[model samples]
Structures are given as structure tokens and as C-alpha cells.
Target: MSEGLKRDYQLCEEIGRGRFGTVFRCFSPESGEFFACKSIDKRLLLDSIDRECLDKEAKIMQLVSGNPNVIQIIDVYEDDSYLHMVMDLCDSSDLYDRVSKRIFSETEAAAVMSPLMEAIEHCHRHGVAHRDIKPDNILFDGRNRLKLSDFGSADCFSDGRSMRGIVGTPYYVAPEVISGRDYNEKVDVWSAGVILYIMLAGIPPFYGESAADIFEAVLRANLRFPTRIFHSVSPAAKDLLRRMLCKDVSRRFSVEQVLRHPWITSGAEGRRDQ
Candidate 1:
């Protein structure tokens, strides 16, 4: 325990766990503030190749944390066995938990999505791709501001250079990625579309009991909006979903285009007027 950390902060219980690290709820006695410290195992990243990936994730988070939709990484500490990142802690739970309780209206979903799309747009603008955009990584702060976390699968890429290697959760992977074709950050938009689908429907757009079945369904690229479940959804909402979920990446609406989308703009205007 003596070598577990530096002296500034005291570690609390574990808040979450991921393949790379365990996140802890920590408190700084001097600042009297709570922060999340993700302790990434240095042993797992001993390989030069794996080390580069984790290093890149930290840089990307540092580069884009200033954005409103993304969580802040306040500081970093490293020891022989671990690399610890001190980050903003969101206590309101994840977006998945919120939606699990009830289906969100188009307006409600739009409000939550507006800032997220901004964050994604900001990341793309900065040449970063957050391959994982599942609901579990999206959290809400005390003020209800949605913050995007978990950039472990994130990458930084050159413009127009195809980012090879399919990375992302199976159910949310873009079709182009599944086809083993060269892909870019547009893949994140597709994942966001999947999130929107789950937010409104309380279920995934594509699903199967087995991993193979899920992959086949994703590869099939058929989106089902059963009237029974979607009858109450609006045309504008469905239109955005259609374009965002378009199988063809070329035909998919870019993040900027999505921001201008009526579904998003209308909700923004509503929120402003209220």
C-alpha cells in the first residue's frame, strides 16, 4: 500500500473497472475535492506496441478534455507498476442507467445528445476518434451535463489516412469496419447513432444471443424500426436516425451536418426558449 500512490490524494473504493484499468473514487485532502483515478496496469502495456496505444489515449484525452462534452483529466501519475490518471468524477451514473428506467422523448434525447455531438465533433476536429461510444461511457454530472468518458479505445489519426484494424464494441461497430475496409472517424458517428437508437427504444437496433449471431446481424446491415416500438417516434427524429445509421458511410450525415439537422436544432431552440 505504501507504493500504491503519491501522497497528495487518498484512494477510496473502486468506481468501475475496464480491461485496461480499475477506476477509483479518490479524494485530495488539500483541495478537498473528489476525482476519479484510473490505474492502468503498466505490466499489460510493457509491449512497445501496447504502450504506444495507451500513451496515445492519454494524449488525446489531454488534447480534447477542454471540450464541454468530454471529461477532464486533471493530472497524471505513473509508478513502476501503474499509470494513474486523475479525472473528473460524475456521480449521476451513466446514460444507460437513465434510459433503462424509461424511454426518452425525442426532445429529451436531443438535449442530451446536443453536447455529446459537440464533443464528438470537437474530437474529430482535433483528429481523435473515440471508437467506443456506448452508453456506459457516457455519464451525467451533478448538473446533468453529459460527459463522454473511457477513451481507452480512442485513436489519433492523420487526415484521409484509413485507420485499419476494426475496433469498437461488436453491436456498435460500423458496417464498413465490419467489412474490413479502410475507415476513418466517421465510424464514431455510426456508434453514436446506435446510442440514440438504444436511448429511445430501450434496446439495441441489432441484437442476438450469441456473438456470431450479433456479428451476422450487423453484417446484414438491416435496421428494424418496428411500428409497435417506434409508432410514437417523430418523423424528424426517425429521419436523423436513418441518415446517421445509413449503411453507406458516404451517405451518412457528417457531425457538422447532423448538428444542423432539424431534429437537433429544433430541440436546441426549444431548450433556449424555455
Candidate 2:
């Protein structure tokens, strides 16, 4: 890698794009590791606050990127035109594509979520809140190792206080977030629950035709596990989802609780039994 925006990596193809940036498939000849280069146009960062958050995002990655399940910023470059970050390229695609297209078995979902919960716990311990924890952000590598990527909407809480402001995809927004109340990292639990629901049922627990409607549904939080969908799902899995998707923050499960949950542990025990 070079000192500035110029580097030895060759950006091969456009892999992903979002409002904040575009991701390109990149290759490094020296390391022989495929990476995804996320480039954010400077014009999109209209103010200093936006730029600060972008820099903070990079800092958060620097703090928690050591985890195997975390797709961290490998290297960064900035100039007048854009800010670019070379990140781990998870070749197996995202959870949205996996479970959204085809429902993974309840046991399979539990196994996948095991590493994810640990990764979230690791981030929380580092005081970084990955506010956005959706299926799209959950990725896997060529070997099917899970990773949680995309830190654009992530936040850091050093002083230990609830963050105020509605930020995150409406589909996965927590009820407190929709109600415009101060909320903590538990918002991520709701998002992870929603992803789990989608993984088990092949659909979002809350549904609507528009963004407003989706927000309303989230605020209501009427999570119904239809028999047609959840008939084959284990009772323990449903219980975990209910605890996670609970509207009351006090009642909702934390990342630690999720790791200790029976459903998750059962999968581990079963694997050992085998």
C-alpha cells in the first residue's frame, strides 16, 4: 500500500452501492487477498459533522476489527475527491441473499447467529454501537465464516448515554427509535431479531407497503409467528426472537443474553453430540 490515495490494489468490479458509498471488488497482488474497496464521494459529506462521523467509523473499525467475524477496514485513503477504505471482501455474499431467498433451517440460523452475537458483544465491550445490524450487513466468506460489515450507520458511545435521533433502515428500526425516544445499544438486538425472524420465516416479522407503514409496524411490534411459516421452527428459537424483538428495552435480550440463550447453546451442544 502507498502513503496516499495511490495504492497497489486494483479495483476490479462494482460489488455494492449505497447512499453513502460504492464498494468495488479489489485485489492486492502482494497479500494475495481479495478485498472490497468502499469509496465515499466527498460531496456526500456536506458538513464537518458528516466527515467526523466517517472518520469515527474508521476509528471504530480500528478498535474492533481484530475479531474474525468482523469485516474491518484493512486500509484507508483520502484525497480531495473521495475517501476510500479497503475492507475484507466476504465472497459468500450476505445473509439477506442467503436467508431472504431461502429460509435456513432453525438450527442453521442458530449456528450462524452464534458467531454474530459474539461479534456484537465484542463491539459493545469496545463501546461501539453497530446501530445497523441487518441481513445485508451480515456477510460470509468463501469458507462460510460469518462477518458483520458496513459501519456507515454505526456509532460510538464513550460516555455511556442513549443516542437520540432516528438513524438506520426503517425496516429494522426499533420501537423506541420510531417513537423518537433516547435509546441504547439494544436497538441492535431488535435488528438482529428481525434478521433472525427473516432467516427462519423467509420474511420480515413486520411488513408494510411504504416506509411510514413499516415504521408504524415497528412501533406496534406485533410480531406474529404464523403457523404456516413457523410450524417447523423450534419453540426455543421463537422464545429467543420474542425476547429480542420485545418493545420494552428492559425486557429485551442483550448481546450477552443472546449468547447465553438456550436455543443458541442447544445448537452448540447438538454439534458436540454429533
Candidate 3:
């Protein structure tokens, strides 16, 4: 632990762990409040790019911290061996957990997506593109409000500028990214579309036994709403999905457009009986 972090917060039991860091439930004695302390080992960031990405993670989070749908960072600390970030402690299961538990109705899916899109919209408006937007990165606070986190894969962009590099989780990556082409923030919309599809259908629109197969499916961008699974979903919902998952970037819906779509604007009122 960083000496500064050690003196500031009392670290508790491990609550989560990732490739290069571990998240612990910690208490800030001064504030007398709980927050998650994410400590990343400096040694693990072996390359310059790795360290740069780590730095961007905090910068990007701070840039978008104003949004209620995004996690708030309280403070950041770094020592010779580790970098620590103190953020709101959201102990509830992530969006992935909720999706795995059961399929959600169109209304329920909308409830989850409404905030997420807003968060993305806020990020885009600020020039950041969350290269990664999978369910695992979507967390909930004690109140169950969505809080997008984990900016290790996020980057900033300006109008007319496209981001390079192949980033994002396999199941939710946009086709342009897989194609090794320059892309824009619309990639986030594609990933969110995958999440929405899984929410209403309980399965990813693209999948395979291996990552390569999954990437192939993503590049193909063949979308479908199975009769059995989508028969009950509203046409407006399907239309939104089609526009969102469109392979042609020209035809894809922007975050603002998606927000205005009929299904979303209609309050996503769906039958629970489905």
C-alpha cells in the first residue's frame, strides 16, 4: 500500500480483483465513510503504454465524475510501488450479475439502459470514448443506480478524429474495431446494443466457443431477434436494436438518437408477463 493511502484510509477485506490490481473495502477515517480502494501494482505496468493507460484511467474517470451514472473518485495516491484510487464503494452485483440472474423485460432493460446511455452521452460530450462498455464495467451503488466504472480502456477524441487500436471485450466489441479500422465513439453504442440484446433475450447477439469465433461473428455483424426469444419484445424495441447494432457506421444510431428513439422515449413500458 502507498504510505499516503495507508495513512488516509484503513483498508479492509478484499472485495474485488483484476489483472493488475485489487479492490478493497476501505474506510476514510476523516470522512468516516466507506470507499473502494483500488491499488494497482506499479511493477505490473511493465511498458510505457501500460503506465500511460493506467494514468488515463484516473484522468478519464475524473473528467466524467460529475455524472450521477458514473462512479465518483474521491482521491488518488501513488507511491513507489503502487497507485491507489479511492472511489465510491458500490457493493451491489454488477450488470453482468443481474443479466445472468434472469432475462429482463423490455421495461426492465430500459430501466438499466436509460442511465447507461446517459452516462455514455455525458462522456462523449466531454470528448471521452469508453472503449470498453461491457456489463462487467457497469456497476450499481447501494441505491441500485447504474455507475459506469473501469476506465482502463477509455480514451478521448475530438470531432472528425477517429481512435485507433483494437480495444474492448470480445462479446461486445464493435465490428469496425475488429476490422482494424479507425473508429469513433459509436463503438460504445454498439457495445451497449449488445447489452440491451442480452438483457431482453438472455443471450449475446454474437457468441462462440472461442474468442476468435466471437470476433468473426462480430465482424460479420449479423444481428437477429430469434422468434422464440423476441416474439414478445415490442417492435419499437427491436427497431432500436437494429439501428444500434447496424454494421454500417453511417446507419448506426448515435447515443442522442437512441435516447430519442420511440421505445426509449415511450418509457420502455413493457409487459412483465413476457
Candidate 4:
């Protein structure tokens, strides 16, 4: 490690690891502040696209630094063998782990979704599309306020540019993404809708034995409400979900429209069974 990149921080156990890096819990000795240090191995940079993605992610984090609902990227530096990013340490489990334990009530769902919607809107306004908006990317603070994370697959929109790459997780990908059709910010909205569906229903709307099957299911399946399972779910909730999951990107509701939906704005009271 380079001396300039070295800092006096107590390195604790690993918090998480992904394809490109490992994250550790660390505490600053001088400030007595805890942080998550994500270190990406330099060896992974052999692939030019991977290196570009890393650079893009770092830049995107820098661009969105001031937003409270987005993860704060405190510092970035390169060591002799790795790139390290120091970030705000969020102690709460991701939305995925929480939903796997129990389904969220309408009020609980709203509380989580409200900040998430704001974060997405903020990113959209800045021309960044968080192509991957799954439950694992949504982290909670001690108060259960959500902060969006994982921008490795994010892309900035430019007119006349074709979004040709295969990105995003199969379960949360929009219909157009699965079909290999050009898409835009609407893809993120589709993923967000899937996240909301999982929050309330405790499972993804489309499921299959394999990735290809999942893609096929997503492209062909009708957006069906599990009325029998969620007997207490309000009609407005169902209506909003339907509009969001539309296969036609042109028909899908925008994030702003979703925020103004009767089910969301009226609060959970309107979503409770009468």
C-alpha cells in the first residue's frame, strides 16, 4: 500500500464482497468515526471495461455526494495493488435481508419507498440511471431511512446513444432490457417497481428455474396481483403496481408519476382494506 493511501483506521471483519472488491468495517482513530472501506483489486483491471466501470462508479459517487438519501463517498485513493473507497458505515441490513424475514406493512413500505423514490428522482435529474435497483442495493440507516448504493452498472443518458449492453439482475430487469431493446430511465423505474412488489409480497413477481426462463417469464407474463395472498392489499396499491410493471416502457409510469399516485400520496390509510 502507498504511504499516501495509508490511514490510521482500525480494520475490522469483512462486511461484504462482490466480483470486484471486498468491503471492511473500519474506524478512524483521529475522528473516532466508523466507515466501510471498499477495496478493489488492481488485478481485476485487466479487463478494460471493468476498469472503466470502476472509474465511472467513483465519478458517479462524487457527482451525487451531497444527497442524504444516497450513500456518501468520503474518499477515494489507489494503493500499490488496489483502489480503496471510504464510505459512510450503515449498520442496518439491506432491504433484501429484511424482506426475506417478513413482508412489510403498507406504512412500513411507504416509509422505505418515500426516500428511495426521492433518491431515484435525484439520480434521474442528474442524468444518471441506476440500472441495477434491486433490494440488496437499498441500504437502511439506524432509523430505517433508505440510502441507494451500488452504482457499478449505472449509466449516464445521452441522446442518440443506444443502450446495448446486458446489465442488471434478471429478476429486477425491465421487459425491454430482457428483450435486448434500447431503453432509458424507465428501466430503473421497472426495477424499483419490482423492489416495491417484493417489499409487499415477499418475493419477485416473476420466477423461474433458470436465468433464461426468468427472462422469458418477465417478457411474457402478465402483471398479476396476488390477490389471494395479499387479501388486505388496497385496490390503489394494485393499480400503481400494474402501471409500473407495464411491458411497454412508454406505458410504464414515470418515477414522478409514481410519487404522485393516490396510493402513495394518500398515505397507508388509503391502502388499508376498507
Candidate 5:
């Protein structure tokens, strides 16, 4: 740890690792509280683009800090060799881990997804788009409240303009992203829909043996709710999924629209609004 960081917090054991940094549990003497510190080695940032991504992650986290469903970055420190970010410590398992351990009923899945949609809506309202919205990015704090983390692949967008690049995990990636076309915030809705599918079905809506095959499936955008697996799933839930996983971006449900859907509004109780 750098001298400035050492003076501020006592770094403890390693808890996680990401593409460019290692996350450690740290203690802040000033507040007598624990936080997760992501220490990114300066050497790994080889170009301006790399440095910009790091800066963007910090700014995006700050941009959406007010949302309770989103992780808040408390402080940031830089030194000769590393960039350190201190943020909320979510020691519990991520959404992926929890879902993998058990199957979720429609109601249970809705309970988990409501706050996540709120988090995504919060990000969208702030003109930010989380390019990556995978299960691993969804975390739970000590209180078990859902908190969305990992802004490394997030970016800001404006109306009438679009973002370029295919940036997302294969299973949850939006079809528009795979098509190499300029996409907007709706891509996130597609990913969130995938999460909903996985939560209820215990499997991804799209599948393949390899990344390429998965990409092909995503490009095909043939969404189906297997009767065997989805027989017990609600029609309202399936309807929402069809709207969310729609290949036509114009027809896909927006985050706000999703929040207001009957399935969502009814608390996903396997019933639709009258």
C-alpha cells in the first residue's frame, strides 16, 4: 500500500480480484468502519484509454452515488504506483451465487429484481448506461439490501446519440450490442431481462457450448420459455420477458416501463393487473 493510503486506512486481507485490480478489506481509523479498497496497479494502465476507463469508473460511481441500490464510493486515493478506491463492503455472496444455490419462484425473483431495476433506472436517469449488467455485478450488503457494483464498463449517453462497441458478457449481452451497431441504454434492459430469466429458470435464456455459439444465439434473438421449465412460471412474467428480450430495440421495454409493468407492479405474484 502507498504511504498516503496506509496513513488513511489499514489494509487487510484480499477479498476479491478484477480485471485490473485486487480488492482488499480495509479499516478506516477515522470512522472506525470497514470498506472494500480496490487497488489498481499503475503499471497495468498502458495507455490513455486504459486510464480513461479507470477515471470513468470513479466518476460514474460518484454520479449514481445517491441511489441506495447502488454502491457508493467513499474516497479515492492515488500514488506513484496505484489507484486506490474505498467503497462499501459487501461481504455476502453475489446474486449469481445465491441464484445458483436455489431456484426462485416468480414472487421471490421479483423481490430480488425490483431493486435492481431501480438501480438501473437510477443510472439511466443520471444519463449513465451500465454496459455490463451481469449477475456478478449485483451484490448484497450486510443488511441483505441489493447493491449494484462494478462501474468499470459503464458510460454516459445522451438522446439522439449512441454508444459504440460490443461491451458485455455473452450470456446476457443485448442483441444490438452483438450486431456491432450503435446502441443506447435499452441494452441494459435486455441484460436485466436475462437476469430475470435466470432467476426463475436457473439457466440463461440463451445458451451455447462456446462464446461464439452464444454470440450467435444472442444475435438470432430467439427467446423461448421452455414449457418444461416455465410451466410454473407466470404468464405476466413471461410477457414481461418477451417484451424485455425483444430484438427490436424500439419495442423493448424501457427501465421505467419495466418498473411499471403489471408483473413488476404486482410484486411479481404470478398475476397481472386488472
Candidate 6:
């Protein structure tokens, strides 16, 4: 709100833009550290309920800070026209950028997935569900370490309470979410499974021509694994994917279960990046 605060940050340039807001690369004169400043327009928040959602996101980030695998929210300030959030600067591109380039090897995939799984496990332990666990939300740090970002769609889970509202990217939405059924942390596991499938196979198991079609496919479609992509993909990986992506929320594996899966534990030793 004060010019002192504004003057402290040297706005470098725009690094990314998305539906919610624009992210600017900035430097703090006091600490001499770089950060990403995400500015959300108050005007846009007026028309939508996302203002409260954004506030929730800020709180979630504050709760999750100090976890090495999660992005750190350094500061939060709001003015009459905008809400500004300062976060740790991650120079490496997102998983989406990497996946678009080519299918990642099992080693590379495991390298990324290890930290990601840890971060999700941390969130679950703290009663938070990311609700949106897609490639785009998985960012890479300057050291190439994977850090989960964008808590805009995250929600806290209390026992027996179901979140009402359609959230998350279309392709990553869980079956329960699509069916308007009561759901919880398991929904995040489903979305993570979809992400795993993409990382290993280079494509989503479900597809459709429209949003409605995608919703239908997510609800009723059987997950298909492409055996042709990687001849060496183990049965353990396929089985883990099946367990995570199961349409029945009750049947889906928990974050802890998924982390202990053979593909994740046994393969951890052999799967580090070269």
C-alpha cells in the first residue's frame, strides 16, 4: 500500500501470464533476492468469487511454506486495485514445458516425481488437498528441483465434508468431481495419476472434442496405456497408475500408498537423472 514497499521491488519483466493474473520477475532491494510477483486485478475479482479463493490460496501458501518441495510465499499485500503476492523465483520451466518437448525417460520422470510426491504427502498430512495437480502447476527451481506451485484451487479437507464446486483444469479433474459426488483428498491422487500417465506416455489417457465430452470421458472412460511408447515401462508403473486413476474414490490409493508403490520405491534407486 505504501510507496516504500513499491520502491523496494525492482520489476524486472513479465515472465508468465495466466487466466487469474500476470507474474512478474522482481528483485528485492533489501534482501537482494529474486521473486515472482503475482498480481491479481481487483476488478476481475469483483465479478468472480475467486477473490476469496485467492485469499484461501495465500493462506494455504503460508501454511505450506518451509516445506522444501513446495514453493515459498515470501510476502502478501493488497491495495485498492490489486492483490500482490511475492513468491520464490523458480527459473526452470514447468512440467508442461518439458512434456511438450518430449516424453521424459523413466529416470527423468522419477527424479521429478519423487519431490512432487513428497510435497503432496506433506499437503495431505496438513489437511490440504491441492485439487489441481497437473503438469503446469509443477514448477522447477533453478537447481531443477521440482516444487509444487499454484494453490489457487487447493482446499482444506475436514472429515465427512465434501467440497462443492467444479474446480481444476478440465483434463485433470477427477471422476467424483465430474459426477458432482462428495470427494476429498483422493481427488488429488486421481489428478496426480493423470499427470503420471502423461509423464510416462506423453499423452492423456482420456480425450474428447469438448468440455462436456471430456467430462463424460473422465466419468466413464477406461484408462488406456500405450505399450508402444516405452517398451520398457514396468508393470509396477502401470499398476500404480491404475490404482491412482481408479474411478471409485474409495478404491483410489492414498498419497502414502502411492509413494510406497514398487514403481516409486523400488525404482527410486535406478531412476535418478543421469
Which candidate comes out best when scored by TM-score? 3
Tell me the lDDT of model 1 at 208.
91
lDDT of 5: 0.91
Better of 5 and 6 by TM-score: 5
Model 2 misplaced regions, further than 4 Å: 1-5, 268-274
Q: Clashing residue pairs in candidate 5, if any?
A: none
Q: Is candidate 3 or candidate 6 better by TM-score?
A: 3
lDDT per residue (tens digit) for residues 1-274 in model 5: 6788889999999999877889999999999999999999978898999999999899889989999999999989998889999999999899989888977878878988899999999999999999899899999999899999999889889666789998989999998898899899999999999999999889999999999999999999999988888888878899999999999999999999999999998897655332
Global Cα lDDT for candidate 2: 0.84
lDDT per residue for candidate 1 within 1-274, as digits (tens), equals 2254568789999988877789999998889999888889888775897888888888889998888789999888887778899998898878878878888877788988888899999999988888888888899887888899988788876666668777788888888887788888888888899988887788889889987787788888788889888877777777888898888888998888889998898883332221
Return the TM-score for candidate 4, rounded to 2 decimals: 0.94
List TM-scores for all candidates, in order: 0.91, 0.91, 0.96, 0.94, 0.96, 0.92
- Scored by lDDT, the top model is 3
TM-score of 3: 0.96
Tell me the tens digit of each residue's lDDT in model 3 across 180-236: 999999999999999999999999999999999999999888899899888888888
By TM-score, the better pick of 1 and 3 is: 3
Candidate 2's displacement at residue 2, Å, is 7.5
Indicate the TM-score of model 5: 0.96
